[model samples]
Target: MKILLVGEYNRTHWNLKRGLQTLGHEVLVIGFRDGFKKVDIDIEIKDPLSSRFLKKVRVLIYKFFKIDLLAHSVKKQILSKKDELSGYDVIQLVNESPFLIDLKCQLEILKWLINWNDKTFLLSTGPDYVSVMHAYNKKFRYSILTPYFEGKITNKNFQHVLSYFSPEHKKIHAYLTKTIEGIISNDLDYHIPLIDHPNYLGMIPHAIELSQLHYKTPNLDNKIVIFHGINSKNYYKKGNDIFEQALDLISVRHKNKIEIITVTDLKYVDFIKSFDKAHILLDQVYAYDQGFNALEAMAKGKVVFTGAEQEWLEHYNLEEDSVAINALPDAQNIADKLEWLILNPNKIIEISKNARAFVETHHDHINCAQHYLKKWST
Candidate 1:
C-alpha cells in the first residue's frame, strides 16, 4: 500500500511511517520537515514556507482574527500535488489541528483533501476544529460571553462542549462519531467508541525511535531519579506541580536516595540521558498513564509511575512485571508509593523489569505498526 501521512513527522508520525514501511508499504509524510531523515521509508514532502516567522505571524493573525494559515498551506499543497496524491492507496492526516490550535485550518485542509481523493482518511489524533475553537476562545472571558449578546450563534455558543475542548460525555461521543472515520487516540477513555472504529489506533508522542532504539540498562545502585513537572513554560496540562508536591513529601525521608529533575531547562538529548540512570519516572496526572516521555522511560526499563485505575491500565494492558508502577494522582498516594519504593528497592527492580517487558509487548514500534497496517488494509 502506498500511504501518505499528512502532518508533522515527529516521534508519533515517524514511528507510524516506519511501521508502515517495515510492512512493505510505501509511506510518505507531508509536513514541516524538522530535520528528520530515514533511508528506506519517509519521503519528505517538505513545505517550503513552513518557517518559524510564518508560524508566529499565522498565530498572531489567528489571535487577532482567527486567520488560519496552516489550512491554507494544506489546501495549496493538496492542489499542487493532486496528481501525486492520486497514486496512494491511503492518505492519513495525523494530529495537527488541536495541538496547533488551528483546527479551522485543518478542517479547510480536510475539505481540500476530500476533494483530492475519496479514500483520504482524516486520522484524528486529537480533538476536532469546533472543539478546539471552543477551548481557545473560551479561555478568555470576553470571548466566552461574546456568544450571549450575539443571538443564535451556533459555533460560538457557550454550551456544554467537551470531547475535543472539554471532557468526555455522551454528546461528545456522538459529535466525534460524525467527524472522522477512525481515531488514533492518545488515551482510550477520552475518545470512547470512536477508538473502536475499524481503523482506530493508539499513539505515543515520543519519537518512534524510543520504541525501536536499543538502550543498555545499568545495575541499580540506589540512584532514584524522578522526572516530574512539565516543560513549565509550555502547556498547562502537564500537571508539573502535582509531581513537585510528591517530590517535596519524599524529600523529608529519602533526600539522599532520591534526585528530582525537570527537563524544562535541559537540552533534549541531555535530558533523556539524565533519565538513563534514573530508576523511577512519574508519567503525569489528569490523564491515563502512558505518553511519549513516560513510554520512553518505560522503554528504558525504568519504573514508571503511571495511573492507578482499572480503566486506564486496561487500555494498554501494560505488563505487570515491567518497570511500570501505579499511583493515584493525589499527593498522598504518590508520596506513599515513592516512600515504599525508597525502602523497598527490590520492588523497584521488579517494577523496572515489568516496565521494559510492558513497553516491548505493547508500545514497541514494530508491534504498533503491524496493528496500524492491519487496520489500514481493511
Candidate 2:
C-alpha cells in the first residue's frame, strides 16, 4: 500500500511509517515537528507560530477575536502540495484537525483528501469529537480534561480541547463519519469512546520500534534516580503539575535516598537521553494507556508512572502495579507510590524488567503494522 500519513503526535506516524515500510508498504508522513519533539517526517509543515513573538501575537489575537491569523497560510502549505499528497492507496489523518489549524480550513483539506485519495480514514490517536465528547459526558472515570473539571487548568490553557465542541468542529466530525472509510484507535484511551460505532474498525496497540530503544537493568547500587520530563504546553493536561507536587513530597521525605531530575520540552531524542540514567520516569496521569514517550521509556526498562488503569491492565491481562505504576489524579497518592518505590527499591527492578518485556511482547512495530494492514484491507 502507498500509505500517506497526514499528521504526527509524539512520533506516532513516523514510527508507523517505519513499520509499514518494513512490511513492504510505501508510507510517507507529512506533518509538523510535533513542537519541540521534532519527530521525523517525509514532508514537514513548518509551524508559523513556532517563534515566541509569533506565538504571543497569535495568542493576543485569539484572546480578543477568537481568531487564527495564520490559518489560511497554514492551509495553503498543505494545499500547495496536493499533487504529492494525492493518489495514495490509503490516507490516514492522525487527528480531526490534522494541520492543527482552524476547523473551517480543516474541512477544505478533508474534502480535497477525500476526492484525491483511494481510501481515506481517520486515526483516533488523539483528541477528537468522539473522545472529547465521551469525557465530557463522564463516561471515562478520568481523562485529559479531568484537571479542567477539577479547576486545575484555566479556560485559556485548555482552549484547544474545548474547540471540539464548536459548531464548525461538529460539522467536520459529522462529515468525517459520513465519508471516511473507518476510524482506527491507537489505544484504550481512544478505544473506549469509539467502541460499537459503525465506522469504527478497532483499536491497535501503538507501534514502537524496539530496535531503536535499549534496555538496561537499572543499577540499584546508588541513590535511586527519578526523571520527570514535562512539556510546558501540556503541563496541566499531562498532569505534570500533579507529578511535581508528588515529587515535592517525595524529595522532602527521602532527600538522601533518591536523586531527582526534571527537564522541560526537550527534543525527542534529547528527551530520551536526558533521562537515560534514571531508574524511574514520571509520565502523564490522565491516560488509560501508555503513550509513545512512556512506551519508549518502558522499552528502555524504566518503570514509568503513567496510565495503567483497570481497562489497560485487563486488556493486557496483567496485574496492578506489576508492569508500571498507575498514576491517578491525586498528588498524595502519587507521593505515596513514589515513597513505596523509594523504600522498596527491588520492586523498581521487577517493574522495570516487566515494562521492557511488555513492550517487546505487545508493541513490536512489525506486529502493530500487521494489525493495521488487516484492518486497512478490510
Candidate 3:
C-alpha cells in the first residue's frame, strides 16, 4: 500500500514510517523537515515566515488588509502540496498542521483531497488543546505546580477563580470528534468520545525496544549514573527544579556513589548514547506515564523509577513496588528509592529483567507498525 504521512516527522514519526516500510508499504512523509531528513524519509518543507522583521511587517500589513488572509496563506501552501497528495492508498495527517487550525478551511481542503481520491484517512495524534493555549498565553507566569498538572486550569490563585475557567475553550474537547476518522493519544486519559468508532484506536503506553545494538549491563564498580532531563525551553513541563532537588538530596548522602548528567546540553544522538552509563533512569514522577527517555532506559536493560499510577503500573504488569520503583515528586521519596536500590543488588536485577521484557513486547517498532497496518486494513 502507498501511504503519505504529514507532520513534523519527529522520532515517533520516523520510527512509525520506517516500520511501515518494513511491512512492505510505501510510506512518504511531507512536512517541516526539522533536521529529521538524515533518518530516511521523503520530506516537503513548509516553514512559515518567522523572522522578527517579517513578523513585524506582517502585523503592520494586516492592519491595512485583513487578519483572515494570514490563515489563507497557509491554505494556499497546503493546496500547492496537493500534487504529491495523489496516488496514495492512505494519507494520514498526523497532527494539526498550520492549515488545520482554520476549521472551515481545513474541512474544505479535506473535501477537496477526498474528491481527488476517496482512499484517505485523517488520523490526529493528540488534541493537546489546553497545552497549546497555555503555551501561547503570556500571563500566569506559566508555572506548573506539579509534574502532574496534566489537569487544565488558568491559575490556582486569581481574582475570580471560577470565572477564569473557559467552558467555550474547554468545548475544544468536541473538536477531537469533529471530522477525524481515528485518534491516537499518548495519554490514556485524554478522553476522546470516539473510542467506540470502528476506526477508533486507543493509546499505547510508552516503552523502549531493544535497539540494533543491545545495551550492556552496568559494572556496579562506578557510581550510579542518573540522566536528569532538564530542558531550558520546557522547564515547566520537565519539572527542572524537582529534578534539581532530587539531585541535591542524592548528593548529601551518596555524593561519591552517584553521577548526575543532563541531556539538554548534548546532541540528540549523544544524549541517547549517555544512557549507556546509567544504572537507573528516573522518570518524571508527575507525568501520568513514562516518556521517551524513561522507555529508552528500559530498552537498555536498566531499572527505571516512575509514578505509581494504577493504569501505568498495569500497562507493565507490575504491582506496587515491583517492576518500577514508584516515587512521588518529593525529594525525600526519590532519594529513599534510590538509596534502597543502591543497597539491594538483587532487586535491581529482577526489575531490570522485567523492564527489558516489557519493552520488547510492547514498543518494538515492527510490532507497533504491524498494529497500525491492521488498523488500516480493517
lDDT for each residue of candidate 3 in 41-88, tens digit (9 for 90 to 100):
475544355576766766677667645444566567667877777767
Per-residue lDDT of candidate 1, residues 1-378 (tens digit): 777777652356767777767778877776654332222224444444468888688768878987666656656655687677666676666653422334444455555554565455545443454333543555322222233334423443333232245433333334444654555554432344344455455543233455444555636575677766355432223445656788888998789988887655444454566777667777665443455667777777777776435555565654442445654546777898888878888887677666666667667676777766666655
Candidate 1: RMSD over Cα atoms? 7.5
User: Which numbered prediction scores highest in TM-score against the true structure?
Assistant: 2
Could you give the candidate ranking by lDDT, starting with the highest?
Answer: 2, 3, 1
- The model with the greatest lDDT is 2
Q: Estimate each model's TM-score.
A: 0.72, 0.96, 0.74
Total backbone clashes of candidate 1, pairs 3 or more residues apart or in separate chains: 10
Candidate 3 residues lying further than 4 Å off, grouped into runs, are 33-41, 44-77, 96-178, 186-199, 205-209, 265-267
RMSD of every prediction: 7.5, 1.6, 6.1
Checking candidate 1 for backbone clashes, the offending pairs are: 11-207, 321-354, 322-351, 322-353, 322-354, 322-355, 323-351, 323-352, 323-354, 323-355
- Output the worst ten-in-a-row residue range by lDDT, candidate 3: 156-165
State the lDDT of candidate 2 residue by residue for 189-255, as single tens digits.
9999999999999988899999999999889999999999999988989999999999999888999
Using TM-score as the measure, name the better of candidate 1 and candidate 3.
3
Off by over 4 Å in 2: 56-67
Per-candidate clashes, comma-separated: 10, 0, 0
Instruction: After superposing candidate 1 on the true structure, give the runs of residues whose Cα lies further than 4 Å from its correct spot.
Output: 32-60, 63-66, 69-86, 96-102, 122-124, 127-181, 184-187, 190-212, 233-235, 265-271, 314-323
